[model samples]
Target chain A: MSENSGSTSTNIFVAKLSSYIDLSIEEHQVIEELTQNSMAFDEGQDIIFESEKNSSAYLLQSGWAIRYKIVPDGGRQIISYLLPGDIFGFRESLFELSDDSVQALTPVIVHCIPAENIAEICDSHTNLSLAFTWARAREQAILTEHIVRLGRRNAYERLGHLLLELLHRLQLVEKAGNSDYFLPLTQEVLADTLGLSIVHVNRTLRKLRNDLMIELDPKTRRLRILDVDALSEATGYDQSFLDQNEKPSRSPQDAIGFEEK
Target chain B: MSENSGSTSTNIFVAKLSSYIDLSIEEHQVIEELTQNSMAFDEGQDIIFESEKNSSAYLLQSGWAIRYKIVPDGGRQIISYLLPGDIFGFRESLFELSDDSVQALTPVIVHCIPAENIAEICDSHTNLSLAFTWARAREQAILTEHIVRLGRRNAYERLGHLLLELLHRLQLVEKAGNSDYFLPLTQEVLADTLGLSIVHVNRTLRKLRNDLMIELDPKTRRLRILDVDALSEATGYDQSFLDQNEKPSRSPQDAIGFEEK
Candidate 1:
């Protein structure tokens, strides 16, 4: 998707921020200056480099991306996935250059806000600073849950949890239907995210399909959750975390420019 | 360490919170009420339980603790370790009954402040609310780092990262010397934390020992990092995330209560 084609005139990012706290006209102007002319990435592109110093943070407009680290043995572990309206690459940049890389999992659009602007915002606006803190804390909670999944849950349970989480997040920005959502992921990509072998991922997918738990149509890139209750039970995921009352202003389609791909 | 020890008479909890924001006399009195008659736990005692509702957030007065979750198959994953003056179990309680457990890794004292009191403070004191937000965000950042470590890094790298993190945290609370820290963990516990087998943990520890990266005296429960540069190089850990400048008034030792154990 071309970034310019999907760019909204409504200042959805500012609108999103307003949901947390009211911003003055001057502060909004400052944010616009901070975000103006930020670059965007195509699907499967690298946004941040591993082991490189970073001076900016990206706000997701549309599509999906992942923050991950590569091991010496050529293994990749996806630490977290960024969805529409999600902000990433800031926590690392806030301290120093990130040790991990963020890659676009789908055709993605992002607002490249300068790190200096973020620091300024934190210094000037206590509310914005608190919002940033809330965002980071939520990120940490997700990671802790992931640790539990990786450390304790089996492959099937982990996959179930991942699906439930994605669906819930999609619902947050109104991207998901009542019982379904589009999951723009390949088996290989899923393997990387879930820390499973491709074969294992394929097997689990088949099992899920056979049990009428989920239906994925690769041709249309649509995911139909046939048994969400069962899946949630298996995953032990409660939707409360996903229903955090914070929503980004842009639609998932607008955020990712999914149609352009 | 008994809860009624003379040294524990001075409330480190209030002092720690004041580091984030200057609490008023009334606010200090409120905090004292919340923490009244809190108990201490010996090493290996559970602070909060899985599937139980805990109304209080703990301020670590002394020693170490861990937040962990258990799987149906009985495997455990230690999500994050709590140091002196660190708070845990409150955020989870804010939403629902606790979904995980907190346990003492060492004999520890903690001031149990009711979650309701904190919520009241946040509602009244904007600065305190901001401080709470920052604390939560910091916790999230740590969890995100752990996800990257466990999902991507090798056993040795994971071990290195874990040790560096523990030592860095210990140093923050002044529990450790300049270059050395006491790690009161066994190979089995380390294996569980790293999601590796005990055999793998032992082999990795031996490799690290042989490489002159670290020296572990299991008998003395002491860990001497021989080469900080090599350790950071191996773990990709940057120390900036450990910054506590916002609350510099509270000594890492006093705020975190490293001496309480």
Candidate 2:
């Protein structure tokens, strides 16, 4: 692994996983090796297509992507965001075909870990395996939140809730400041994600700005949640699902209790 | 395990998992023991409440449930349905608290597998562990589809798509016949699930019946999709995500290949 790539690509991952469990030097080395080789996709390019037989799981080293599907009428539903330090393709390992396609919303870089390597890693590295499980659970929680966002929330709550989520998720990987992140999404993208029209998304953004809930710089594509606690209270955005309080043990032998040994 | 409960409960799970990979006699026994002791909940009872510290994963032995969350405005959003043979709560193992609450839609029975037992089982039993992983992947796929349903599809498509999904998922565990099942859900439940109002859901169901796409008997609480192919095509309901075609190898030693030994 080149020292430059190792420091850049693997840092986001190590930062994310370190919150769950303290990694040993060997574990850190394994992650660095796993993410050394990388591939890049330009903005608007398809990273992984739907129904494809993908044999490897990918680690998103940098940039932004979306996992999405198209309805019969050609309407797209953005399933979830694939941010830095996020893992993908692994979920497709046991499936016959990929359900949703992933696309790069911005210039994106990733490291592919073949299925065999994933299985081997999980079998040998208990700490890494547990971290993967934790990641999956976190992803599920986010999807559940998204479902609720679309199913119940109005345009304003939906937009605010989503921004809050991005801010917190990006903050975890040091991709954002205390309450701001580089949000390279078009109003159309936000519309597709929030189940609204572009006009509606635009109106909602204006309302949020007028209401002092958020600030979005169109040129820089950066968003800042001015009052996160108030917006969270107004929108029912709970960060507890994304935050881990107790450090789980690295091995199954010591996982019985909820404390790190 | 009593022979009667064993035949009914474990059979569904065995039937579901058997479609993915053939289980050894010992694996069947393990499932049987895991489900032998179960707790029952009456209709309208909370199976697992939101924010509850859950220490055990659950196996749904019989009846139906819904995983849902309430918005700040008291609006409820049903995230996903928990059917017989479905395993849950394990997803909560890594999270500090449950993100959503699970409620019994009918008189429900579930077996609790403690967190420690889950860790030990996955550590020792590679096949069962893989099966769990497969189940998690399938659940994630379902959630992804739900997001698409909510975000992209109209009321007609959403209602139709969800019914097709339930039909296929229920059929996987022998809980449904060729094209019909006992659907014990009210219009309110349907409204919460499909992101529509009760009046809208009722109107849509009537429209579906009028169009000869479905037959829902209110008296018996049974639903029959007259032509699944037509409905699926119309609603963009793809069963490929729920259906398993490839039998993955049970052991990681042999998982490198696609086919089962």
Candidate 3:
């Protein structure tokens, strides 16, 4: 059951934040109001580009977007995907130019807020800043895990781990007891993201389907995990990185003198 | 030519920060003072552990450290490397638990600064905050590139790209007009980082060395790029990701209403 208790549109990103930390009523109101100012985009459009002078960031009110980089050979690498309730462009508050691009993978609705407004909110609301910071930490952590997936896991493990990861993140935003979710990505996109050939991704999916571990519905673009635990086991998927605590429950042996993980 | 008029200690990290943006005199002094409060570590020591309650972060004043995650199966994935002048631990100001560990790759010296101090500096200095934020952005971008390496590049391309990367980063701190650098990593460590078997790593190294694109003196732990241009071309090693600007120059098609790059 969703923990939110109001208009679902405004509550989505807030509910997602709640999964990371608690927010005060005022903070909730700020995000809810931010959600009210939204825009829609159809699939396969670049929302941001390599050197955009974007003064505003965005909150995904609906649908999906992806961060990607185009290499010298004209190859595109999808850096990260943005789901509803995910915030984007806050980092530009620190820098002037955009380093990468964002393209909508599906029809998306984004809640736009100028960087100055975000800074304004952050200056007055410590909790809001903390919540946003938590979001960024998770984003960095997610990128770290993706690196591991690319460097270590085989194709089968990579596919399983990726699907489960998407499932878990999607659940945090709009999961409603369904083992299935819409993933509006073509096999080519999957190949690009997973560093596999389209043929390899297809073969891996076929194997997973044949083994009854997952079901893919291309017609509706829906993905259902027949067995989450099995997929997790097959991939040695560690969830701790995905679930970051707001405060320390248990400290590690060494405290403050290492590099970013 | 070295770009230092006074001492190398203060300018090491400053030089690094200068790669993206310029720093004011006050900011320079702040980092210099931070270096005065330094600590030493022996090789193979964990500076931060998997769930550490670190209230401070460190700057690599000397030697090298790596950020890594240990799986339940006892496998370790090195997320990123900390070269001299690189800072660590500031992210914990946002979250409680340390998601990964930092271990000294060599006998190392680090300038430790409490997270609060860094925060205080950022609160007062906009330029300093931009520097720190740039560091984090670069870190995230580094992880993203590693993911691409793992997902797409073959072993040859991965090793070539990684070496070029390390060389480029090392150049920022200490180039001495030499095309060679010290990389005190064993074949085992390379195997772990690149997701290859030790034998495979050895084979790749031998091939690169044999082809005269690169040279490795195993006993000296010295690596030399015989032809940086050829290696870059052979592997399609793009440096754009590593060289992130503090702001935009030419500008993207859409300015403010887009997503993070």
Q: After superposition, which runs of candidate 2 have C-alpha atoms over 4 Å from their true positions?
A: A1-10, A252-261, B1-10, B252-261
Candidates in order, TM-scores: namely 0.72, 0.93, 0.85
Candidate 1 deviant stretches above 4 angstroms:
A1-40, A46-59, A72-74, A89-94, A111-134, A210-212, A233-261, B1-39, B51-57, B85-90, B93-98, B112-138, B198-218, B225-261
- Per-residue error (Å), model 3, residue B90: 2.3
lDDT tens per residue, model 2, A208-252: 999999899999998888999999998889887688877776554
lDDT of 1 by residue, A1-261 (tens): 334534356554565555544455655676666555545678888888875777677778778998877765677878888988788877654344246788988887778777667755765654555456445656666777789877667789889899998888777666789889989888988888777889999999999999999999989989998989989887776765443443322122322211110
Best by lDDT: 2
In candidate 3, clashing pairs total 12
Candidate 1 lDDT score at position A116: 65
Least lDDT summed over 10 consecutive residues: which range in candidate 2 chain A?
A252-261
DockQ of 3: 0.37
Per-prediction DockQ: 0.28, 0.71, 0.37
TM-scores of chain A across candidates: 0.85, 0.91, 0.87
Task: State the lDDT of candidate 2 residue by residue for B66-129, as single tens digits.
Answer: 9999987899999999999899989986567456899999988888889889988888777788
Among all windows of 10 consecutive residues in model 1 chain A, the one with the lowest summed lDDT is A252-261
